[model samples]
Target: MTNLQKAVILITGASGGFGQELTRQLLEAGSRLILTDINEAVLRQRVAAIQNEVKTGEVLACLASDLADVQGCETLYHQVKALDIPIDILINNAGVGLFGRMDEIPRQRWEYLMQVNLMTPMRLSALFVPDMIEHQKGHIVNISSLAGWCAIAGMAHYSASKFGLRGFSEGLFNEVKDYNVKVTAVYPFFSRTPILQSERFGTLAKTYQGLPEHMITDPADVMRATIQGIVKNQLHVFPDPTANRLHLLQRYFPQLVYWINNRMGRSMKHG
Candidate 1:
């Protein structure tokens, strides 16, 4: 079991609903936290709120840095390293979503989503994995999405980013398993997070409006499952029931999965 007590964990996008919930749960479990987000004020506010409640583990530092650029990723890494704290666990939770047709979505937005969702994790992992290897211990959690496994309309770029992340996480897991470093890829279905408030392009707003609200998972439940996965050293985590069932179905009935997604897309387009 991974002992979080006194373990230094760095969580990106700590101000978001899922990220904030994860921060609270991890702190309650006695993990030292170094939280980061693009919005410094909001990140620090969340940190203060958690400290006011749990008051157990240390909140090492709450630094805000944009992770959508390589320099930003490097800066965050160096900032943490300068503090002389060995990050025992790194949670790559920062991500953004752009909803629209593949052709209609601007290239700039697609690149931004890819940078934040895929490249940032890869960059951070590259920077920290060596240290974990030298110590022969550490954990990295990449917050991928259900879209990664199953392609869906109106989320082409977002799905691509997550799919890349899923592959990277799996490859990293194999590469580091022998060295005792664990890489967990979390595939959560839509959650009731601010990410749902993502910018909608083309006809995405109309499509999203037709989606069932009940389908969205709870951030708290997702965070609970994530912490459990981390402790158990799970390589692939399907936290939500919907995602788990879909993942199994995709494995057993690939054609059925494609048909369902195609049907959903048609319905959204017509509705």
Candidate 2:
């Protein structure tokens, strides 16, 4: 189990919906943070806004870097390494949302999505894992989604990227165990995050608007569970109760999930 108190943690996408809340909680847990995001201005803004709560969590560095491409990830890695700080925890929390049919969304966009969601984490992990192995202790928490467990309408490519992340994270967990390095893949269903307002293309926007209030979760609840899981060195975390139910259903009754997706997708395709 990793003790977060005074642990050096580097979090990507530190300016987004999930990133911001996770940052606050990590800070409150007494973890020193190295926060990064693609947008420099927004990153700075977020760090400033959270200053009041930083008494417990030290802000080591607020470097801004894009993770959408290999170069970006490489440069960010180098920047962090140059700081001469060893990271105890690496949170690959940065990701974007794409909503549309395969043909409706441009191929390049999915390519970008793949880079940010799957390959960027893979690249960053490759860059940082050796150091953790050498240190003989570290944790890597990947924020995946429930969509990774099952396909979803208007998000086929998104699901693919998450599925890839889940597989890679789980594999890394095993490979790095002997070295005392840990990996956890977190799957959260839709919550009240900005991702819910993600850009849509040929999509039925009302589908999310129509979801029962109980089905969507509170982001705080998800992150709290994630933090608790991190402390236990848990491998897979289904943070939301509803999402947990869906995960089990997806595992045992996949056809039902697929059918639900198909029904929603038809509306996105035709509505």
Give the 10-residue window scoring lowest on summed lDDT in candidate 1.
203-212
Candidate 1 residue-wise lDDT, 1-271, digit = tens:
7888899999999999988998899888889999999999988887888789887888889898999999999999999999998999999999998888888888998999999999999999999999999999999999999999998888889999999999999999999999999999999998999888788887665656645667678999998998899999998999989899999989999999999898877766665
Candidate 2 stretches greater than 4 Å from native: 203-212, 259-271
Query: Count of backbone clashes for each model?
Result: 0, 0
The candidate scoring highest on lDDT is 1
List TM-scores for all candidates, in order: 0.96, 0.93
User: In candidate 2, what are the lDDT values of residues 1-271, reduced to their tens digit?
Assistant: 7899999999999998889888899988999999999888889888888877566878989997978888899999999999999999999999888887677778888899999999999999999999999999899999999988987767889999999999999899989999999999999988888887667666444443434556578988899998898899999999989678889988899888878777755644444
Pull out the clashing pairs in model 1.
none
Q: For residue 182, what is the lDDT in candidate 2?
A: 94
